[model samples]
Target: MMLDSETTKTYTRPISKAWWLRDRGHFNRRYFMFLLRELTSVFVALYVVLFIYEIFLLTKGPDAHTAFRESLSAGPWIAFHIIALLFALYHSYTWLGLTTKMQAAGRGLVKIGTKTLPPILIALGSYGAWIIATCIIAYLFLTL
Candidate 1:
């Protein structure tokens, strides 16, 4: 996008100096918070929906529940869960990784730090933390 002075001038919302400094010059910390919360919200919704489907099957009687149990024990569903987990992991890494690199949706490149470490390092750290946390959680659940 050609975000020249004229382009900025044509913005539907008035541009403030504070906004530019926050989003363009400084790291877009606000967006970081929003994305973090939004991602979690979406994940929770999906989880609830999946559980509702399972609950529905359970209520459908012994045959449906038995089939559901069999399907849950099946390899394909396990594969699907693995795929979903990996997808979420990758998506989170990419989203955070872009935080330091993404410019305003239409503005010029926004630099975050003077000697900013590459975003991949943060992304790698996030993935590592997620793996550890997920394992710990799964272990606790399984044991319980």
Candidate 2:
């Protein structure tokens, strides 16, 4: 059975454009961090775009690629890279920790046999794997 539209009216609360910024008490450190985490994606996307552009520049011959390389070697470019690296690191850290949060939420993302693994263990495993991979890559890069 369908209810009458007049009798079953729903109220939609009016929210400000800067709702996130408006609520100082409700939007605490966690909310700010969440926003920061989201902002990290912009830097990551920018770096990916730059990398693709560099690859495209390579196809345009040595002179174009050399100019791009020279521009990247400048102070401002170096600072941008450093900032991007920090944001990228933060993004990666938060991403890897998400598994632990999910597991801890009792969703059973990490389970062994009938028993569910602890959140800390899940976090450790992810971070450990990341460290191992980084070490291997670093080793290869240094050697080759």
Candidate 3:
């Protein structure tokens, strides 16, 4: 049996348009940085959507795609890209740092004889892998 609408109560909480920014009047540097780090995904998602739209424009012909590409080369787009890059880098760095912490916590799973590798080494290895992957993608793009 379904409950009657009259008996079922609904509650609503008023939320501010800038709710996320409401309590930032006294946030420490680290807390502010954490907020910025979390915001990185918004920029990253915007960039990805932009990239996909550019690819879609390619199907419209070279003229359409070239015009779109030239438009993106403008100052505003360039600045946006630079800011997005910085945010993306921050996001990646934080994620890699977390990875290092996880590895440190799971030291027993990756022991060499009787000693476990240091967290710094684990972080470095993760960063190295990221760099290598980036280089490979760049190389492929340049060559193709």
Top candidate on TM-score is 2
lDDT of 3: 0.83
Question: Cα RMSDs of all predictions?
Answer: 11.9, 4.0, 6.0
Cα lDDT of model 1 by residue, 1-144, tens digit: 435776467555444465623654566776665565456646556656878998998789999988877887789778866765665665666665564354323332433665445555555665677779889999999998
RMSD over all Cα atoms, model 3: 6.0
Alpha-carbon lDDT, every model: 0.64, 0.88, 0.83
Q: Please give, for residues 76-104, the per-residue lDDT of candidate 3 as tens digits.
A: 99999999999999998988778788877
Candidate 1 structure lDDT:
0.64
Determine which window of 10 residues in candidate 1 has minimal summed lDDT. Answer: 102-111
What is the descending lDDT order?
A: 2, 3, 1
Q: What global local distance difference test value does model 2 have?
A: 0.88
Candidate 3: where are CA atoms >4 Å away? 1-25, 105-109
lDDT, candidate 3, residue 135?
100
Specify the highest-lDDT model's number.
2
| Reference-based TM-score of each model | 0.40, 0.82, 0.77
- Candidate 2: deviation at residue 108, Å? 2.8
Q: How close is candidate 2 to the true structure, as a TM-score?
A: 0.82
Model 1, runs deviating above 4 Å: 1-48, 56-64, 74-86, 100-121
Per-residue alpha-carbon lDDT of model 2 for 11-128, expressed as tens digits?
Answer: 6555556555655335556666778899999999999999999999999999999999999999999999999999999998999988989999965686788889889998999999
